[model samples]
Target: MAVSRHLLFAILLPMAAVAADFPPPLLIAHATVIDASGAAPLGDADVLLRDGRIVSVGKALVAPPDTQRIEARGRYLIPGLWDMHVHLLRKGRPEAYFPLLIANGVVGFRDMGGDLGFDEIARLRREIADGSRLGPRFIAPGPLLDGPYPTLPSITRVLRNADDAAQAVLDLQRAGADFLKVYNRLPRDAYFALAATARAHHITFAGHVPLAVSAREASQAGQKSIEHLFNVLFACSSQEDALMREKARALDSTDVDERRQLRAHYLQAVLDSYDPARAQALFALFACNATWQTPTLVQRRAYAFPEQAAPDAALLRYVPHDQRWRFDPGQDARLQGRDAARQTLERRYFDMDRGQIALMRKAGVRFLAGSDAPDGEAVPGFSLHDELAELVAAGLTPMEALQSATRNAGDYFGLGDTGVIAPGARADLVLLDADPRADIRNTRRIDAVILDGRLLQRAALQALLDQAAEAAAGP
Candidate 1:
């Protein structure tokens, strides 16, 4: 992807003259580079960037007289993070969320689903590619394909049958969507059709497991990734039919005790039927087929405590006031309004989130970290770090958790040169003041971020956040 000259002019006009004269290469000296490709961090190393690409990386490199140097000192430098799932649309100006992603140290994202039009999103992708926008690299699925009448406002297209499913994939491909998203309501035939068509066209199919399709069947049928852990829980169960039948009967009944019994039965069944060998086989299919999992733990956590007052301070700070209100407007009241029976049914779903994560990891599932942010209690940017922290709580090592956001995502998306710090790689790196390996929370101690050779200090990143907040507040 070549950066356009016009884009350069539009973005760098103020600093153009100062940047024109080939000043010595920007050198990041004496930093520990955690080059995310499973390599040992190099101590006392310097990375030199020129023309937005890494030119050299090693120790004992002499800095040229004209070289502008960043004294990394004792900081840890790693590849800029990637959020595999995000909704790039905001409340007022839908396009405002992109820059905010960059501001929070995300250099790239995969928009799992959003409300933006395909043409507009394509333009934004191009603009970011051309350097016309100060945003992270984007990959989008355009819109969702739902069935039995699309319930979500974000879904612009719906599949009525197998033909509709095939045509929907074609339309999404034509609209420049990078993948096809399957929703929960899709019919079995339509689900298979969508997956087959996507495979034939070399488009990745991802999202929820329809009620008619088991996770095992979907994996074998070429569904690229599963968004939530619910699908896996379904597959891991040895008695899915019995469980589903119980749930259906519970739904049909108004008796509180009956519903409670059914809910308890389902949870107990899940714990009893969780077979490690079966999980390993299922995850092997995922790994063999190059499938990915975007476990949006933040949303899972938020929904876990439905009766809670609101989101925590860190997440609340990033969301616009109106959007925050929209997400939690008397959520406690709503929870209270639900009969105890119905509340328990919903709560059962929440309790399985951590267990699902643990089971997936135990089976060697390839996890991709995502917040599902700015929707419900999950805020963007900052919420991603919370996801990392949650993954650690779920038994993933800090390095393993970080890999889910970096190298793992890049590999899944076929981005060859962006996830690791190496010669010839793009200069998207984060310099942290503390050792994140020691404590995952240390990732918050960001000193600076380098995006395609452009150094943004902490103040500049904060300014970007303020700009996003302002735009989100607009009429």
Candidate 2:
């Protein structure tokens, strides 16, 4: 299903959408607006939406004679959230999770590498655009490109040399992938070749900094966004050159026991060798290049302390039987047969990860909120809110945390009108019972969600949750 870039664009024109079947003009009156444009919240304002785009926002606005309106006094309005990293195809239950995501106000996302092919994802995208589906708008990397010895073979395409890597960039682009997802184990030559090919083709490449490449090298090569802090901690170590040589071997080895021992050794080494000066320089380089980071602290914490990662009883009901094993601590590979010393070291690594945020922010490095949801203990829609909480705990102001999922996402995607509340912007918004700027956790107190100008009130949102629960419970 290889499509030329021109044909792909023609077919995907619906993606730049105003909902095809939305009702007449809708008015939301007396609501306080948190526009996510770094502006002060507007008090007691009125917002008008027509044809799936915001038509006006002011202190008071009148609507058409036949307009539908929501009296939103005492509520706060904000842009709908985006989970920057997700894997919708891994478990293959998008039918169930789509409702859950919308219920939690996730209007958009970026799918990292997954099992679904590009053609199928494009079909889903079309359905969502035409108002035939109930899910977030997304940009996806159909399958990730990895090294000769591919990791996660089910979702990876192996590139053994520079030629293969370069060709893959062209091939994935023809297949209509939004961007190239580069993974670990890539040889240095292949990684750079992929980057060069992607640049020539006008497609961006993002994801892991391969074992053979430094974060600085990846940034220089124009990797757009780095996910999960892979390679970053090691790159910030004073002993980076020596440690990386050892770390690369650890990852490339086929022997599990040998690999685990090597990983344990380097984990402690990275912790002990962290150099703030080195990190400052690295962060400065990242800022200079405008590279974004999706640290995904929620999943990292789950991996660090699996015993405490279990979801609460309420959330557990949403975990399907086939997927529940992933939530179990016993299934955590990091915890299996590890000694007390390794466990303590892992905790310290997580704390160090949290500490990196403050320094990186100070050095002008920007972030995007991602939960790596349904990976480890990250639950589908709910885990995004958890990621925000983790970001605030890690030193982001509530506004900064909100921007990671809203304004920053729009900037990253180059969609100027998607993540803000203003005239001509997409009518995707969230209404909260409390002001999220006052306390980040108030984001969870959602009163309603408006997607493409069609409002879903509190009862409607609850029905979506109930529908998801029923699907999860079914055979």
Candidate 3:
């Protein structure tokens, strides 16, 4: 899987695509358009795109003289999907994965955390932004802002106090970060200072609600989004204060036996303290504050059931054979080690996350669909489909699930010109072989992808996948 850069470029840089300096006018005729705005799909729709923007969308449209026509008579069309969380770090071979995003119709994604010194990451981001690169749009916080003693020292900016936190925010923004990503274990004072500094700089701060800050307080204080249901679960329980104190004490311990016992007690207390009323209040606060949620349910599944991470032939084709075997020791090695207690806790957390998601929706809390792609367990592109299915399983309708990856995603990132398929929106769309309304998994049946008006027909898309697989299975 150690591919030479020259070889990788040869395979991935499609000559035709690179040669097309200007996008052609394309007309997709007789397709079903699912706009993902809760409206019914329009049958036999004719869509027109010229120069990376949708020019016409209706029941009948005569193609322009220079238009390239595609007969999509029986196809279903939807706005392109977005993965709200991803990490295309250099170590992950981001170059090999961009095609996967286009192959799966993921046109936008967020790289939540990675090494700040990973120069290739920002270069790729710039390339995409400047339209020289073709793939998902990238939003990232260069590195994670963590407490004094960071777990991942190399990728972390250790902040000892509020002054350090404020300075870190300024430095990160100056370094080209789209937003600020705060990590767990950040001191209460430092986290708040980071938040305030980010606000002053007109940048949004999103990520884990530090363990020191309750979810309600985080929402009230303007934490933009909470990742992985981290603080929400504990903060919503009736035993919030007690559970938090116990969790804090347990986490601070060094002795193995004592920490294990305390963790067990804390988990049990969390399981028993489900409070619908408290959860309702918390969700209300989130809605009012416009705080978003990226549950990353796919990650939850990988943690709760590590056996599923076993890559089959199809999966291995996209991920390096060596990289496929390196994810078991992430969380105390609980997954690979198969610790029964950790499995039980992970499952509970997963189920609890589902419940919270249902309640959050009921309380009108907006959400975004994220796969945490290439994050050890989840596969890129494909995991977004899995996340949509998980959302439906968690009580969101197929439409609601789709919206999380579409409109909600666009709104979260303040990209108003995209997300919809109407005239004037960015012409990023997916042509499906089947109606996704019947089954969320139908989203995976991609027939074609319209990426920035560059039509990737089924055959071209397949070529992209094949190239990714070959790059992964290097000679």
Candidate 4:
């Protein structure tokens, strides 16, 4: 079957002046094309791009005189990757952050949530579209719309009641948000109010499954996507109903320590009582409601095995000095003077995360690969590659993992213009030094990155990284 007719947000990723320039066709000749649309690899094929769209993909297609040829006799060609769930800036400048994406062959990304003001977010996106910034195509929620009690009050828009919830949705959408991001503490009634209002405005509402609501109810209420697999894991556990009851009571507690103890106890209960049959039922509902899951298993694993995360000197160059703690294993609370009990819980959650992916696959529920980076103290550009590898480790085939980053995300967010290499798709392509199908890690071997029909040659791509490193080195 062909790709869906999902119309991308037009202004969401408007190409630069390269679109009007009608740059000469970029001929990637003699490459093995793994389109990521489940089509068999086209051995020794030529993929042509012109005017910001893929014009053709075939064997030995005629190379016009006006074309710039990339001799790819043994290389692999695929759609540029998308990081579906990311927090773009938890530490450094957006300037220092963007080039790392292109340098790593990530041409598109969804800013799951950020602290940037609405206009600032709009400005950054506009810069990318106008070719003024060397960043990936950005689509983000204006700011987080959280419950009255929020963890990050600076970036959060507090919704104290159902009326506040409804107004918050309208206000954020009007302020040029790509979607409404409902946060964890939102009451069930307020969460529904926001969802209903988002539906009325024809906007996408996504984020956490509120504390009082089950994943099934969120899916039923038109929650477009759920990030971090937040409450879904427990929602599928055998103790789901009981856990929900407990959570409702926990919210009323003024004692912070008491709440934490109760949370830890009940979470342990969830892992012990996990039921595959119940999981299958939740998966069925998720599939039925067309709600997508962005499983940021990387975050979960980082907490579970913080000792394994040694900072890389090379990758840290792109990470600002103050922001480097994000990559520090010592910073994770789960690892700081760990007890055997907490370790077991972390390990169980990590295993359950993989189990959830396998079950989601069996139930035919779609997934979007998200790094949940920056939030995980992840080094932005490199963390996405790690996320892909983690997806494969969890149970996805290389192509399946690639799809979660590409086609599945495109389908999820209606960024149909990108995430595929085909006639009329966006001309964002990545040429790898080796076939990623053979090993998903080969995706990291980017030989060249094509963005908006403009080629960034290997040397040019290296320069982007170098410049980012220099900027990040700033005091």
Candidate 5:
């Protein structure tokens, strides 16, 4: 449970060279401030920033005579967003995605497991700290801790026993991981051991609820956050225990084809046996335990209805050539060779997932906005906006959707001064050309971004986008 020196450095150095990179004391005059604190927007507000922190926020903020000022009249300002779940170094060059994230107003992120080594992650952190890179501040578990037979063995630490589980947790904690990234296919006993070790060390472990463990058990075991809503649907089944047993067998199987068939059958059984009463009870339990959910609905939707994964020309301009194939359903094996009945089942599962999300929200289960970007049709940064829209479509109010990425994210990560715009808060603000409160889609109408007090106005933001596109286009 001991935090590594590197982890401590990452936490302590919020902005190591901000004074040199940013302007003098800066002020934004006459803008609508949507602080994302579940409070009403303050109109005609002025916010002053100095040395990477908000100096003041009010109707009239006094600043030094030489202070740099932005005439933000008619614009809306809110805390910069956080993509609670991301895979920055998963597929493409991680640096190439940084400008895209910043251009879309994502100032911070939690990188889900990727292929990068801890040393590489540390290097990226150093570059960002020294203002040598344009990117989001991030916390990551360099790679996932998966079962002995992992889905992505190349980017995983395979655990075989209780001893392995315990050691994995401690090793990741000491390797500067913000939290342990658990995965599917883990043995039940090993999962419990991992969870116990995490709790003993006062470290957090979160990710997929292992197939051998039920979601209820995962919630009770203190898994901090559930990603991709994995196993949640099955837990809402009236025959949950029966389905879980089948899942356990699937996990233990040596045959890949058998495992795939078993998983498909188990998922169908879950869909068939879903009970509203059971779903409600499970959601209540999650609420009670404060188990956070990061559904990554955009990615789910893409997988569910892959036939509709037509390439988006506008968004595609920013996607790297090698990665653009992910936007085409015809190229995906899962999307191809699906019969009519299979398509119907996929649609049904997706609808139920959205319905369950709505129910969970009403039951007071807190959510974190995440787009499993570059995984599905989800494009980094832009997909986060799609996620907010999807959240709203699933019955969240626009403000609530916005909060999932902002206030809720800050609370989830325990980043005190983040995700809010107030005196003493981090100077990571997004200026929107339209008010997001009126429509969550307005979050995409970003006019400017202020990262660690260094303002990127419209032109600078565009430059970031242009750079990203050029990178995507390759040399």
Candidate 6:
């Protein structure tokens, strides 16, 4: 079961070998292109793709004699969307999620946390890159590092102290992890040590801001990104209250009311201390500091509303019947006597967290759209579109929300040639039925998804989704 580096390369070698043959160019014509670069959408444009790269894009582009042409009339083309945060191995088979993501126009994803073997993930990345697999590009950490009893069970290692944290980073770097993911339970010293070690190893540090460390400290310490919107909530809190809260004991179900009161007090203090001058200074620091945030509002909304705990129909199709009962823990925990109170606390946390996201956006903090999809209430590819919709609800314009998934993510991850439709950019683009520039919801009307110039039509996309659902339902 251990996927080794050699095995991974073996799995990918066929794709690279196939790509060695020069294929005929693919020409897509008569499409409306939304390049995600804030450029005006081009009407009746033609995109020329050759050997898995976009060679030209313009109106009335002439195709070579041997080029295979795809007529895309009535479709709107844009760069493929990126789910900036996801956990590929949460549902047991990380590979199953790839086609589902591609089906819904998710051409790239950052694995915020997962238990996937690095070799397997790297293999999948290579296979997709070389056109062996029908999937999106993947960026992932090897495993999660946390103190004892981390919330997510997929965490492969635990850090007990600063030394453990430092060693964990080096181990992950050796394992070829794309980044170091820190969890919420680590102590202040361990968190700082991990950050320092990640920097020394030149590995990107990302994940939850530990309760013991202030968000500002984590940002200043070179943590590349923060997940779950918790860091922003901590950042918006009054510095004095944040310091006090950091020393408080871990929260428990019995102390739910007390936690809410403390959180409210901290939030009010933050709002009261909201000096525009101070906020501007803080925003400047974040802008230059390379810190990113994934709001993951789709998951937030799902956790917030227990009254509506039923799964979305599209999502339910992919979740196994045996696992369906896992969706509503409160209902399952009716015999435990703690369900009601826990549900109430969850709802409260959701509302406050969303409010914190609004505040962070207003303060000019950088954000990456992530669904945390196919995890609990999130529904993989569909959840990302919902993230964009929720972001629009939080006051970002359609373009801004789209940017969060496109150019913003590409720029943040140093993928300069992607997230745009230019002369030399990669051909990872989606063709929608409607103009998403006019409305964010139009993003869902996907007509086709173009990955490295190979187009997957809507019917093909549906087939991929069906295949994933079948795989998830299998014995």
What value of lDDT does candidate 3 attain over all alpha carbons?
0.79
Candidate 1 lDDT score relative to the true structure:
0.72
Q: Write the per-residue lDDT of candidate 3 for residues 1-475, one digit (tens) a residue.
A: 1222322232223322344454779999999999988988899999999877799999789877999988999889999998988876646466578889889999878788876453665566556645666667666677888897776678888998999999998787666666778887789999889888877777788888777889888888788889888868888788898888787777677777777677767777787887878888889999999989998888877766777754466776798766766544354344444367777886786788678898889889988999887774777888899999988998889999999999887677665655788998878899999989899999999999988788998899998888788877867
What lDDT score goes with residue 472 in model 5?
Answer: 89
Whole-model lDDT values for every prediction: 0.72, 0.86, 0.79, 0.79, 0.86, 0.72
In TM-score terms, candidate 5 sits at 0.95
| Residue pairs that clash (backbone atoms under 3 angstroms), model 6 | 374-380
> How many steric clashes does model 2 contain?
0
Best by TM-score: 2
Q: How are the candidates ranked when ordered by lDDT, highest leading?
A: 2, 5, 3, 4, 1, 6
Q: Which stretches of candidate 4 lie over 4 Å from their true place?
A: 1-13, 16-18, 89-91, 245-260
TM-score of each prediction: 0.86, 0.96, 0.91, 0.94, 0.95, 0.86
lDDT of 5 by residue, 60-114 (tens): 8788998999999999999999999888876465756889899999998888888
- In candidate 2, residue 331 scores what lDDT? 82
Q: Which regions of candidate 1 are displaced past 4 Å?
A: 1-24, 63-65, 90-96, 130-132, 245-277, 307-309, 312-317, 332-351
- Comparing candidate 2 with candidate 4, which one achieves the higher TM-score? 2
Q: What is the C-alpha RMSD of each candidate to the true structure, in Å?
A: 5.0, 2.7, 5.8, 2.7, 2.2, 4.7
Instruction: Point out where model 6 deviates above 4 Å.
Output: 1-18, 21-23, 126-132, 239-248, 252-281, 329-352, 355-359
Model 4 per-residue lDDT tens digits across residues 1-475: 1211111443334664335655688998999988898889989999988888898888878867899998999999888888888888433568677888888888878787777776676677667767677778767776687777785778788888899989887777666677778887787778888888878777887888878789889999989888888888788777888887787667667876667677678778788888878888899988888888888877777777777665568778887777777688776543565577877777886787677888887778788878876767566677788989988888888999999887876787655666898898888889999888889999999999998888998899999999899888985
CA deviation > 4 Å runs, candidate 5: 1-8, 11-14, 17-21, 248-264
